[model samples]
Target: MMESYLELKKRHQKEVNEFPFGFAFSPAQFVEMMRKWGLDYEKDINKIVSIGNGGYVQKKDRDNMHEMFSRHRKEIRDFISADESGEEFVYKMFLREMRNYGYGWTGDPKDTLEALGLTWEDVQNNEKLLNGFNKASEVALRKVI
Candidate 1:
């Protein structure tokens, strides 16, 4: 089941990379996505929380959060590598990471672009489009989690 979930996650990550922007996912959408990934929310939530809370820092269970972020990064990297979308995959991967790891206003487009080796100017140039994409992903994430 874990392998199946991982495989499904890999496939979705690939799809996310290939497309990068434009898809609007909701909480229901995410639940469906998870289902497709072979993940059972009831069974996996605690594990996800545990993984998400792991970190090197010590502050209100910061380590656990850091650990989750670390796991998420690894998963993102694996998915990005398997993506067939070429260079665009990197951008898409960053966006996905931002949505998953970034919280509140910190999930800005500039931050996401910088994380992807892009400059603010690059994001500024494509502001309208990226904002839409980011909003869509964020909304979907909020609904699912």
Candidate 2:
């Protein structure tokens, strides 16, 4: 199961790295990926809730995360409003958020991406970007675990 998750993670990372501008995954795709990884989505969701309760995100980091999420949302909205295809805008937004907040999905990013018509690959690339995303994700995972 861990290996499957790792494989999915790697695939997601590759997609992000390759596109860095497209971030769309249908709900089915997202859920299927999770299922394929042997994760019970509900359990993971509960784990996230537990992590929040545990407070490992820290007040400061939580505030920072909110700020980051807000900024990314605004950026995406502005980008979308500027004459691009909704899909393109969405893909950019997904990449932006994943690039900034990390891409653990938890479902939010994937939903947002689907709404905007982007894919995971659209927003992931560059050694620095991937490293940063993974680092953030690792932190989140550590908190949850």
Candidate 3:
């Protein structure tokens, strides 16, 4: 079943609200957290996640992840600003994609992923084209909280 916006927010809040400071974490732990919360992860094959690699999310890896996240965030924001109706356009396209992907009858975020033909791998590969939808989902998800 698809997770509700409230449910996602609740989970996100639960995890981040009390995140420990100065507590070191391995990439595996972070991946586990994401999985527990139904988040898509592109870090599956990382050596650190496997415990056989460096065993921690190394500084370089952490920096790379931050860079990737920033890039996607900027693209989404840019898309939303490029057109006066940019936000509206993403929502419209999200709805259309949902319908096209056979979720025409529902408004679910999981369905949104499916509608856009996105797996985490797909998102990783085609983020420029689809991150706006992802960003829109994040905005909507956060707003509900």
Given candidate 2, what's the lDDT at residue 1? 12
Candidate 2's displacement at residue 144, Å, is 37
**Candidate 2's C-alpha lDDT?**
0.42
Q: Taking the tens digit of each residue's C-alpha lDDT, what string does model 1 give over 38-143?
A: 5564665443222132311123344544565566567655544454442244434544646655633454555555555556665446544355345545664575
Q: TM-score for each prediction? A: 0.27, 0.26, 0.31
* Better by TM-score, candidate 3 or 1: 3
Query: What local distance difference test score does each model get?
Result: 0.47, 0.42, 0.47
Task: Sort every candidate by lDDT, greatest first.
Answer: 3, 1, 2
> Candidate 3: misplaced stretches above 4 Å?
1-59, 87-93, 96-102, 107-145
List the lowest-lDDT window of 10 residues for candidate 3: 47-56
| Off by more than 4 A, model 2 | 1-55, 84-145
Clashing residue pairs in candidate 3 are: none
What digit string (tens of lDDT, one per residue) describes model 2 on residues 1-145?
A: 1222234345545643543121115656545544654555566433222123222222323455566556645554454445233333333333445444444536245653454445457536333334433454555445445
After superposing all C-alphas onto the true structure, candidate 3 shows an RMSD in angstroms of 16.2
Best by TM-score: 3
lDDT head-to-head 1 vs 2, winner: 1
